[model samples]
Target: MVEDRRLAVLRAIVEDYVRTEEPVGSRAVVERHGLNVSPATVRNDMAALEEEGLIAQPHTSAGRVPTDKGYRMFVDRLTTLKPMSGAERRAISTFLDGAVDLDDVVQRSVRLLSQLTRQVAVVQYPTLTRSTVRHVELVTLTPTRLLVVLILSTGRVEQRVVELSRSELPDADALAGGGGPEVSAGDEPARVVDAVVADLRPRLLGAVVGKRIAEAGAALADLPAAVPDASRTLVRRVAEVLGEAMSDHHADERIAVGGAANLARYGDSFDSAVRPLLEALEEHVVLLKLLGEATAGGAVTVRIGTEGPYHQLASTSVVATGYGPAEAPATLGIVGPTRMDYPGTMVAVRSVARYVSRILDDA
Candidate 1:
């Protein structure tokens, strides 16, 4: 366990270093933290911490900066997360209340988190693989054209179009020369489409809808003797959400952010370190993979320096929490730097995660 005075000094050092991006000396620590300790005594404790690999001097004459170990200890033993202000909570509620759809909520969340934390923000769309199919519709357009629509429990929608040739119709006798039946003058095409949909459900229900026509042929064969040469438009708007959920088994739902602009005003090393992280942000899969491992043990996770996947992000850090519906596995938390304002960042991350989980639960 960390002693209270040493922990207080450590917390003071972390907070000061994060704000100034400068090495902290014992005299400065004593003066700023008001620890009631002499500079000599503070120096002795600093030496002890350095010996423990918790802090390090950049050069022979330079003051100290918190090492990854130091930051870890600070996070584990010293930092007290500050709660969001009532005004801040009200603002978050108001902003989220305006969201009309899943996409709207996600976009709003990313922007709100970025603004509040002044850090890069990332948010994964809700996982859909475990979500049940809420509704499915098959619409017939012509003798050869059809449309398939799928809705999920998550309020996501996917659509596909298929074309059928007269030769493929098993019920060729029901049509005029297998050309298919022409609607009467007063008949609504939508009603006929609905009838066709009702007939197709038992055969196609819960089947994996693929991009190729041949993949769907087997299911089509089970249909009420449909025609051949069936072509499909294969519209898949929510394909990304489903594809990620299905294909990225080891991938956690997460967002990668490029908040380098926020750190750009710091020093050259910070700028250099932040650039690669920003560039790496484009690869969403890599970020999600890292978060997957972090949340695997069901704990708030923190990875610093080379401990994380992206070696180019060696100088940066990530602090994330897991959150989701009770039945679903947890999603990831906000990620930022080791030098980040831990108290404030933790509050923002936890707050956003709770709101996101609530939205998913309600959806």
Candidate 2:
């Protein structure tokens, strides 16, 4: 019972410190909270908490503040995350449901999180390796030039231009007997591009359905055989261009961040941790790794000050969670000072992540 009462004192201290951004004193705790205890008794509990390294007195006479260890204990011991209000849940769903596509969903989520938590928010794009092809469009620009467009289920599009080796059009006599345009060395490549586009349109690029961009590209390795002998060269070039476009998509994974201005709210209180955090936020790789560390198990993860591997972020805390399918989930989270509203922020992060996952699942 004594240890439990001490923990209650520690919790009171943390709550007051977060609210006022000032060290909490025994008098203030007794006055602001109904602990039903005397000032002297609270003081003794505070002393015990300090002895355990959970609270610290910044100066000789100032009240105590919860240390990083204290915050970790609070988070670990939290039995229930604070629930969002009815208005808050409605607003989140309304805002996210307005998103038209995957990129829009990511952008909207970053903005929503920042607004909800009043903290910097980071949201990663769906991985290309996990997205399937949505559409493939081939447009002829000239007799020897064609544009190949690859659209993915994640709403990412890639385009490339494939130039034929031949200067002269294919022979028209070869295609004379068919319902389509005649094909030969002297005939325009546009004829073949047009015919192939029509054929593939009905098929809906079945060659790439359900497979990742890279896998789809590989499956089309023998595309040349699917076309007439006269169009063999053009088919091969189209496949090659599609493969290159997939390579480009695989190299570009992106993330969105917003609400950096919120960090300035800490002012002098976070002087030690703000500068490096601002710099690290500018780097996508560092942000990705941070979020990656949290969502490794596809659950909500909280990293308090000094818990994050980097020394510079020791004064900041991260509340993050994974969104999307268990097979290929993405990360979303907020970054703030250690003396933050943990319960509220946890609710916001976890709630937003679930909404995002729902959006992706439906898409």
Give candidate 1 regions above 4 Å deviation.
Answer: 78-80, 137-149, 159-191, 194-260, 294-298, 326-330
lDDT of 2 by residue, 1-363 (tens): 888778778888899999999989999999988888999999999888888889999998899999999998887888887688889889999999998777788889999999888999999876777767778887878767888877776655677997776643344555555544334444445665576556544443777767776678777786667656555566677788788777765643488999999988889988888899999998998888777544423667888888887887889888898776554557889988898988888898889988888877676
- Candidate 1 local lDDT, 26-67, one digit each (tens): 889998888888988878788888898888999887778998
Residue pairs in collision within model 1: 161-233, 162-232, 163-230, 163-231, 168-226, 168-227, 168-228, 169-226, 169-227, 170-225
CA lDDT, candidate 1, residue 177: 37
Q: Provide the TM-score for each candidate, comma-separated.
A: 0.72, 0.86
Q: TM-score of predicted model 1?
A: 0.72
The models' CA-based lDDT, in order, is 0.61, 0.79
lDDT of 1: 0.61
lDDT of 2: 0.79
At residue 260, candidate 2 shows an lDDT of: 94
lDDT of 1 at 225: 39
